[model samples]
Target: MKIHNSRLISALFAIAFGAMQTVSAAAETVRSLDDLAFLEGHWRGGEDFVFEETWNGAEGGVMTGMARGVSSGELKVLEYIVVSAEEDAVVMRFKHFRRDFSTWEDGGPIILMLTDAKENDVTFSADPPSETVKSIRYFKTGENTLQADIVLVEDGEEGGFTLVFDRAD
Candidate 1:
């Protein structure tokens, strides 16, 4: 009976290990910015508040983009963003600006490192790891539609928001 029980335990352990391997394999690390070429173009969203983004195609291992938001016919926010391949990971760095062109960050750009990618979906984590904003994900839902999900982690609490974008070009 003791031997039988030990064999059953070993079999269960093997099965659990195999399942873990499968899960890990599904989250492949991002290799290049080429896979993200679909993101290039002008995209717009929001109704009461207008949001727009324009992304340049990848070139020289980098892709540059800009975003703007307007409310009540007044420019509210602006952002400059870039994606670049650095070693084994793709890094997304962005900086925010006010309508008056004043910078939001004092020191450096906010950095987010690619963590996992599959098909048209990609995930990025805060570069220095933040307690407030943890990760962000972009998903291509249709030929001309993109969705962004931002994950927030603060005070041991988790929260997030999603933004849907439609191709303007």
Candidate 2:
């Protein structure tokens, strides 16, 4: 291989500038829990079954929440959720529980890390790629309307459901 001096310098400069751009872009997406204050309120949505979620204001860099589903006037599913601002990234962990307090996620709470954030949207992806959920996204469609998309994966296939909620509080 013949390498010209000018070509070598050009390649080196390209690599250096590319690395800087990558780093700068990544830094722009970093978020803190305070950025998610919109989630602190009551939300209700669902068709066949009524589902409700409530999130508390972020305190000490953490927000705690819970969700439950009711069908036929009977409580069906319950979930405990926590979103925290870590040193490097914001993280969300949630666990589902049955009416009897039995867990649906036998392994452990599903863990997701903040991957993207926009003016009124935030997305968290499975940290290590869980079997049940691949990612979850929350975005505001209107001032009092919010939508949540829960992405799921099974058997190497991708599927998801979206929930549209109105401000309940």
Candidate 3:
């Protein structure tokens, strides 16, 4: 009788574990749009990047165009980023898009944490094993401008530049 009771207790414990996992996952579901609704306008900015190397001439430059949020399935702004083109498997995603059929996938960065509304900021770690490049993007609202600042961190240390933007209008 003791052996039978022990087996019954084990079965009950397994069932409880499965139920707890489901509840935890639902808690992590989309609670509100507070996470991504801040970035919703046109912005213009100049982007510049520098590289370190043993050789004398191996840096890069770009003319940046930026566009923010969308509605009714459209590209609403002119802002831009050339990051994914140079790197492999880097992608972007919004809450609306689906992974099974969307070309712009959510593979770029994890939205690690968020601040209050009307502020745009993100922490991104690109290619976890590669300590060569990782960064944070911080954007904020202004009187007559909308701004985004990009700061890169390498191997747990912070380096790179900040980009301040003006409203494109």
| TM-score of each candidate structure, all chains considered together | 0.77, 0.83, 0.39
Cα RMSD to the true fold for all candidates? 6.4, 4.1, 14.4
Alpha-carbon runs more than 4 Å astray in model 2? 1-26
Please estimate how well model 1 matches the true structure, expressed as its whole-model Cα lDDT: 0.86
Error of 2 at 22 (Å): 6.9
Q: Report the number of the highest-TM-score candidate.
A: 2
Q: Candidate 2's residue-wise lDDT over 1-169, tens digit each?
A: 3568889999999999999999998788779887788887999988788889898999988999999999889999999999999999999999999988999988878999988888778999986779999999999999988899999998978999998888899
TM-score of 3: 0.39
In candidate 1, position 141 carries an lDDT of 96
Candidate 3 — which pairs collide? 65-79, 65-80, 66-78, 66-79, 66-80, 67-79
What lDDT tens digits, residue by residue, belong to model 3 across residues 43-154?
A: 4454332111011111242112233433344443322332221222223222222323342324542222222223354343444422433444545656644444445456
Sorted by lDDT, highest first, which candidate order results? 2, 1, 3
lDDT for 1 (candidate 1): 100
| lDDT top scorer | 2
Tens digits of per-residue lDDT for model 1, 1-169: 9999999999999999999988787545436897677778999999988889899999998999999989999988899999999876888998889977889778788788877777888888996676557888888999889998988876878898887899999
lDDT scores in order: 0.86, 0.90, 0.40
